[model samples]
Target: MFARSLGWIVLLGLTLQSVQARDYRYSDAHLHYVDFFQESEGMDALLKAMDQARIDQSMISGVAVAKKWHEDEPKRPRYYAGDDADAYWYSATDIYVAAALEKLEPRQRQRFHPFLTGFNPVDKNAVAHIERMLELYPGLWQGIGEVFTRHDDLTALTSGDTPRANNEAMTRIYHLAAEQDLPVLIHSNITSKRERNPLYLAEIEEPLRNHPHTRFIWAHAGSSMEIHRHQTRLDFLLPTLSRLLESYPNLYIDLSWSVLQPYLLDEQGKPRAQWLALVKRFPERFMLGSDVVGRFDSLSEQLHGFDPFLDALPADVAQKVARDNFLAVLPKQR
Candidate 1:
């Protein structure tokens, strides 16, 4: 009788362990295929990282601007913000992304969704460039942007009139995105570091209101690492995001690594109640991303950082934010 009891106890222990183990799968919605120099670690490395991270799918795009190594600077800058050298719009970035995808097998290629981000957002001809790319790729391109506009320091460093989401050029692009059913991911900051309010809210709001048919994933919910470093936290961010989510049904949020602190998770790494409630309210409108550019060794770490926040959410809501939401927002027919 004691031997029989031991066997049942061991079986129950194994069942409990299975129940306790969390299966964490993710869809990285805001990944960059290359770095500031317009270079990548290649598709092989990216795929290996994805498999280890359990990233079933990813939205890949090239950086809009390429960092220049000016003659004045003796040493090359390691990153875009490393030196005062200006970055330029490199249309060839899209070509690099396409070539990388072509090298992959059909099944491997299907795992990645590529976005075109090589055009200057402020130029009228930018729309034509996008149209030409769509023709050249013929169904290879899945979306547009990570379009740099009104970004903190990058605005001053980029070699062009600063782009605005509501400008005429972007307006035309929005119409094209709507017609093509492509989602556009934009990095238009909500406000400058010095401002306590939503100083630059209109830049994004105008597009959201004007282009209702176009799906827009507001990168890091309009926050960046530079903004966070200066302010520690945007006191107005939660309320501002809540209002926008309610007002614009088409606006989606990208919860990348930058927005993790002082917003999603608190200083101590615990999930904040307000953000949790906000995400739960619009679970289908929020998704997680690594936002890792070029090198991806930290891909798993960047994504798994959301575990605490995900654990706080209801299982179904967490699932949507973790993997389902991004896939849902992709071009429906694609």
Candidate 2:
């Protein structure tokens, strides 16, 4: 009876701590306005989720590429975009983002920041396409990407071009992003899920070295859900991240949902000491992302995932990761 009472006390203490951590509002560094299949989940649903969750701001974008259906597959996979064949460039996806922004009331519109996606990273004309979008919208886009590169099976299936983060076309786009003062949110997987080795490290590293003036947000810190499923423990992640963070001031990390599991937290759901230390060392360099595509129902859980870690942080640093760091990286409204 006494042991049972002690367990209840500990549980209640943890519950209260969670509540305290969640009391703070958020600015989601990564969010998607569209799904992999080119469906609009609508701005209304997003706004309602934000209101309910007390999310002050969100950096939004459409999927950069559409997942291609594999002809040989007897049945298509439902959740992940890369489960089948080539992921194709979906230029129209950006239009959905624009339309959603148009539907918002002027005041509520300011609460959301839109990013430009859809251009093929390997296309020489990609820079021109982005320039045209900038001209047409005239201050509508706050940033560029969730740009996909070196992804999972998607890389094998991707047609027309094999996208590399440091390719000539992407280099030009980075220059344009710097010129426009926009942070680039890039999704370049560090390693293939099956390999669990740093095969694609140089792809992201070269860009970081080349673009000192441009701010680059590394989505999921170069992780993916599929990658985590293959190898739950990211033993090398900390050392690699530390080296990069130490080298590049222009680089930032997006700790999206994929990284929350064994990378940041242990199997027991406690914040891993190493990850917690990294965040403390670079409080202004890290941010949280839901990486949610076309759905707002999971928004609360996505945002809440960081609560324990946030609770462990110094108050100022916690606030920065939760909201200020993301806000700081955004292009100021003109």
Candidate 3:
């Protein structure tokens, strides 16, 4: 009877520990207030979701580019990203995001870290628009991006000149970001979906090399949902990321959901040793993000996905990845 009772006590203790681990409040480093089509569930729904998930803060941005919907087609494409037509500059996206932030009560507003994403990265004159927005809003804008450059599917459908992270236009924007002490979250895909290798490394690498002062948050660590659909898994991601982290002090990674599969977790849904060791070695460099678009209902599950990985980490390191690391990269004024 004493042995059985001791076993029950131990079981209860373990359960309580798991509950405690789940209770850690999160800071979402990557989130979108709208989608390519400009649809959203709006601010109230988002705040309620955040409260439910215990997400203390979030880095929110508008979808940088707009999707083109073809009116004449018999079967209309649901989103412009995959459609045959091209998407164009969507400068008003920033305004939509800013207006949502303004609608919030002061207490509610404090939880958001808004980043500007409406301007064209490939437009040389885009910097002037950003300056106007920053001047108009003053301290309201916290950062820049998920700047969509070299995105799969979206890249093909985008009109005018294809944007690259290393372009002269983007170079000017990086300079502006450094001047304002704002971190830029760029979504430059590491490789094309058709190719299994890191063929597009130069698009992201060139910018990182040039902009040492500007803190660059490599969105989804250069991986995306489209990449996964084509290749069963990315064999090159782990080594590429590890080497980049070692090479660039200004580079931080947004370990969003796309990166979780085949990298952070094994096929059996267990944490991978290579990933854990890499994160542990650089605890301060990694941040958690849901990368959820236009909706808040999935917020909790997205944040909870990190729990297993967190459990394997030491308490301090887990806490850092879950919260501190994201907050650390935000603009100092906040």
Which candidate has the top score in TM-score? 1
The CA lDDT of each predicted structure is: 0.93, 0.87, 0.89
Q: Report the C-alpha lDDT of model 3 over 1-334, residue by residue, as the tens digit.
A: 9999999999999998877744588999999999887779999899999989889999999887777767866675667655587788788888999999998899899999999999888899989999999999999998999898988888877777888999999999999999999999999999988898999998898878888999999988999888888886788888998888898989999999988886788888899999999999889999999988898899999999888988899989999999989889988877
Off by over 4 Å in 1: 1-19
Model 1 clash tally? 0
Span of 10 residues, lowest total lDDT, candidate 3: 74-83
RMSD of each predicted structure:
3.2, 4.7, 2.5
Tens digits of per-residue lDDT, candidate 2, 87-198, equal: 6788988888898899879999999889998899999899999999999999799999988888776776667778899999999999999999999999898888776577
Encode model 1's per-residue lDDT on 184-204: one tens digit a residue: 999999999788788999999
Off by over 4 Å in 2: 1-22, 69-77, 80-83
Could you tell me the TM-score of candidate 1?
A: 0.94
- Candidate 1: residue 10 Cα off by (Å): 17
Worst 10 residues of 1 by lDDT: 16-25
Q: Give the TM-score of candidate 2.
A: 0.90
Give per-model TM-scores. Answer: 0.94, 0.90, 0.93
| Pairs with steric clashes in candidate 2 | 86-157
